[model samples]
Target: MTKRSDFLAANKGLRVARAGFVLLVLPHAAPDAGDIRRFGITVTKKIGNAVVRNRMKRRFRALVREILPEHGLAGHDHVLIGREGGVERDFALLRKELLVALDRARAGKGDPPRGAKGGRGGGKPHHGRGKGPRPAPESPQT
Candidate 1:
């Protein structure tokens, strides 16, 4: 699932969020694609610097490899999205959470839709320069 489209498609699928990460399960849509189970990891810059993001990705990959083979659903694209505290979390705990997430996914259970929680978005968009053109500097008030 190296393509951006794959990730986007997966985002529209089932989502299970754990303390350490969010798991997205996209069932194979095309019969011709076969039962090829693919997976991807996304750790954004918001999580940390490059080093921290990479470390989280590494941990996610290891956990996926260890657990996916036995517990993962075939013909699905599994995407793990890293959260803020994921880096500092214990590996054992993360692994346990992943297992629980997978089990929930297996049972066709997913957390609420991302937008269900709502956002702090009623205010207008803000830019660093502030309030659109600053009233054209007021021209000394004549």
Candidate 2:
């Protein structure tokens, strides 16, 4: 089992690699370091009741165990936070999401760069220019 100290140390050491579904916080550790990377799972009360939360945590742990050896940074600490939907989400989808997040993290110098956006129909700027028409005033309700 992973140790708490390792997670603490990792949090202290490196920047975080994050995605919408998961956040990976990695610290710098040597490839040959004897230290076993640690993992921590956190699911907030907003997710669900104790049972549901526990289930989410378990799923996250399993996913981490399965993917860590292949994608984990040798000397980093990692934490996975489960959203409310995470508990009900399919395992395969979760795995795919995690892997995509990890890949971006790895490729971009251990943390995905900020402002890198992607989504359905492509990412468009959220704000309209000042030239856009203003909204009309609402009429009085009957």
Candidate 3:
């Protein structure tokens, strides 16, 4: 498990954006460092009232605790954003989403391709390399 101080130190690290979520990932640059990772949850007032926000934060914390050991990067700082409907969603779905997002963040930072890009087709998916995917083309059926 990563120490709280380490997480604080990771405050300035990589960041990834997704729908209903924003992942802040800070990779460990120093060699010989231990494989330690910590997670922080941020839910702003815009998300909801105290109860709702707290629930969201709790959910995020739980999700991180469950998945970090397997997928979390060493000496990294991670903050998961809690958006509207986040707290209301199903736990399994949320967990799946969180894992996928984290994987995407890791890969985006250069993990390697899983199967070429999906049908989304914005060229090869450059993990964390550029601005993200381009907007989809509009349909012309009239």
Candidate 4:
């Protein structure tokens, strides 16, 4: 993406988490001329050394090259974030995960998957931090 805000904005869009990577898909508000799809791949240093990171990035690019043309939605921006398993995982499995993630994302089936924390307030009940009615004092017996 041209700006950091664009990548940040994509984070609010649909997300699919696989063992090897996380896919973020955001649909464009207006399809530009040529209807071309754009994509980005990120391999963090935390994943490995420079060599490993580059390898992961290359693998991701190849995967996108093979998959996105026919399967990806035009006017949608796709970002692939590499994870710890990205370099070690089998290529075939990675492909399967990507395809499944894409289908689920488009179908809107994987938004906040099962057992995930609920949205807003971080799934915690708000009780005003122990604020409640005071207990009444004991009355004197007759």
Clashing pairs in 4: none
Q: Which wins on lDDT, candidate 1 or candidate 4?
A: 1
What 10-residue stretch in candidate 4 is worst by lDDT?
113-122
In model 1, state the lDDT of residue 3.
90
On lDDT, the candidate that comes out on top is 1
Question: Which candidate model has the greater lDDT, 2 or 4?
Answer: 4
Count of backbone collisions in candidate 4: 0
TM-scores, all candidates, are: 0.80, 0.60, 0.62, 0.76
Q: How many steric overlaps are in each model, in order?
A: 0, 0, 2, 0
Give RMSD (Å) of candidate 1 vs. truth: 5.9
**Best candidate per TM-score, number?**
1
Candidate 3 local Cα displacement, residue 65, angstroms: 0.9
lDDT of each: 0.91, 0.67, 0.71, 0.83
Q: What is the lDDT of residue 137 in candidate 1?
A: 59
Name the lDDT value of residue 15 in candidate 4. 84
- Model 2 TM-score is 0.60
lDDT tens digits, residue span 3-91, model 2: 76655554443344433245656654656655556677878898888998888888888899999888875565667767667877789
Candidate 3 per-residue lDDT, tens place, 78-98, comes to: 778677878778888888877
- Model 1 C-alpha lDDT per residue in residues 16-85, reported as the tens digit of each score: 9998899999987788656577899999999999999999999999999999988888889999999999
